[model samples]
Target: MSEQRTHSPQEPQRRPRITHNRKKTRRSKAAAALLYVLFVVGLSAVLATVGWIWANDLLALNKDYTSVIVKVENDESFGEVVNDLKKNGLIEYKFLFHLYGWFSNADDKIAPGTYELNTDMDYRALVTNMSASSSTRQTIDITIPEGYTIDQTFALLEEQGVTTVEKLQDMSANWNYKFTWLKDLPLGDYHRLEGYLFPDTYTFYLGEDAKYVINKMLVNFESKMGDYMDQFTEESQYSLHDIITIASLIEKETDGEDYGTIASVIYNRLENTGAETQGYLQIDATLVYLNGGKVPTEEDKAIDSPYNTYLYKGLPAGPISNPGMKAITAALKPENTNYYYYVLNPETNKHEFTRTYAQHQALVEKYGTANEEG
Candidate 1:
């Protein structure tokens, strides 16, 4: 039935060899699995170390307490911010901060200014401290007096280290400020915003932007003149610009209690264009403006300038100076009077108004004509 096979001792040995090879394969596989586990553990440790460092930087943790001043220039890129932070010891990792900035929109939030940063501030706090409304930024309190010309205002701002005069003048002339009332004003002249800069004390950044500096004053003017603006319309005889121009004249003419009376004289002169004044304002203050803030001489009257009320008719092209609320109110609500001419009396330091040229001449002779001498 079945053929009997002879068994060699070597056959048993070959079977044992096969078992040994299988054992060896199993041992090799176990070794590979242990190596893979060791590799994963090492990689995880490295990642955890890196993550901890980044987290420490982001949260401003465990670092020595230090304070530094960081200055971000106008239009500066975020790279520059990172460099400043790095240089000032405010941050240790520039690349990580940049990534955070990109994700958090820190570039848009951080404004150009001088900031006082300390080790206590986190990355988010640092970004906030550099913003336009930052409490840590340096500020200066300045008082811009009433009747200040735009030049005077700019000079004052420069003196207080708020901004450069050249920058202010440039922005005032060319910048297209977004305000409904400013639409009619044409650009190109620095004096275009003369009457609109409301005179008041303000708190401004030490090195503020020119646009923002000017905008603050303009916004103040709008806020103060809100009620008057509501009363004006397209059908009104005098626009807000005209009223401001008139107010400027009144502001320079007298500082006493004659605001309403002076305003009445101005209206009387303007309304009676056919009268002897011939629509010419004939104001000595305008001549002073033409003569570079000097007391106008008799020759200044003859020099041809649109601001010279003696030479040209109507409101001296624009406002001569910034007016306060009192002057503005007088301009809006002038006293009802029939007087057309006025002369400042030196003895009383008040203006004398009269309807006739002869009366004004008499008063001028008595008062020796104010601010007319060379």
Candidate 2:
């Protein structure tokens, strides 16, 4: 048995041969890896194609169309907006547009308005232009001139159909605004907001309440008066109301360049301690206001009105007109002078200032008329 085993071993030990199943298993693994790589590449290409189409749709997809007005209702939904764009031919891809809106968080931010849209607008432009609050409402441009009285301003607004006269009068009388300067104002007629409405150009929208416009003017007055607010402390001789009243007088009395000098004359007349000229402002403009814009006669000057400076000493009951910034500034910072009288020189359209009554009489004789008195 040993000799036979040795003879077989000499035939040698044949190594283990590779089976067909094993070779097939290795080839299968390589093929599976290659197929997986090919599948991944194909999926990536498909995704890239879809991304490019979506981006193109969001950008300049509709660049050659005419503009169209599209109205979005107040409680409209994003889906409804997308449908509206599709219906108006403003957008082509509804799904992609909605997706873009969702991604940009613009779906919830779209304002309800009548939007001016065009097929030439991209998704971004359409979203931006349609989101404005003003686009939904109608607006009017109103220009209120300087030195216009409240009555005058009301007339102008009524003429433009901005509001009714009754509404404006009602608001003016009873608004009870909380301005600090309006706190201690002397009780007067419904024109309590006389000088408080700062005169300037304004833009008012249609359908706005009367109080809205009034508050807008008051806010503008407060903003413009910010520069002079610090000067109106308790130590100052005049309140803000007093300064505005004086400024209104100065505005009606003289031109731009002579505001400071006219303010000085007003201050001199008020601050004078002399027995002859003490506490008498003698402003003819106040008499004009009392006479309802008419030239005041001697009888009109003697009328019993607090606004009559010829009768009542010191400033008038309130402002005579809404003065502009130039007059307001001059009233805040008056020229330091002893001049107490001024008369308009017809030859030069300027005021002639004088210190004493005698010098004032000289200017009156030189420049005054029977109807015009300083």
Return the top candidate by lDDT.
1
Encode model 1's per-residue lDDT on 138-236: one tens digit a residue.
Answer: 888999888899999999999987888998999999999999999999999889999999999999887789899999999999999887788788999
Residue pairs in collision within model 2: none
How far does residue 97 in candidate 2 sit from its true spot (Å)?
Answer: 30
> Number of the top candidate by TM-score?
1
Instruction: Give, for candidate 1, the lowest lDDT window spanning 10 residues.
Output: 8-17
lDDT of 2: 0.80
RMSD of each: 5.8, 13.1
The deviation in Å at residue 366 for candidate 2 is 2.4
- The per-residue C-alpha lDDT of model 2 at residue 193 equals 90
Report the error of model 2 at residue 58, Å.
30
* Model 2: worst 10 consecutive residues (lDDT sum): 1-10
Q: Score every model by TM-score.
A: 0.74, 0.63
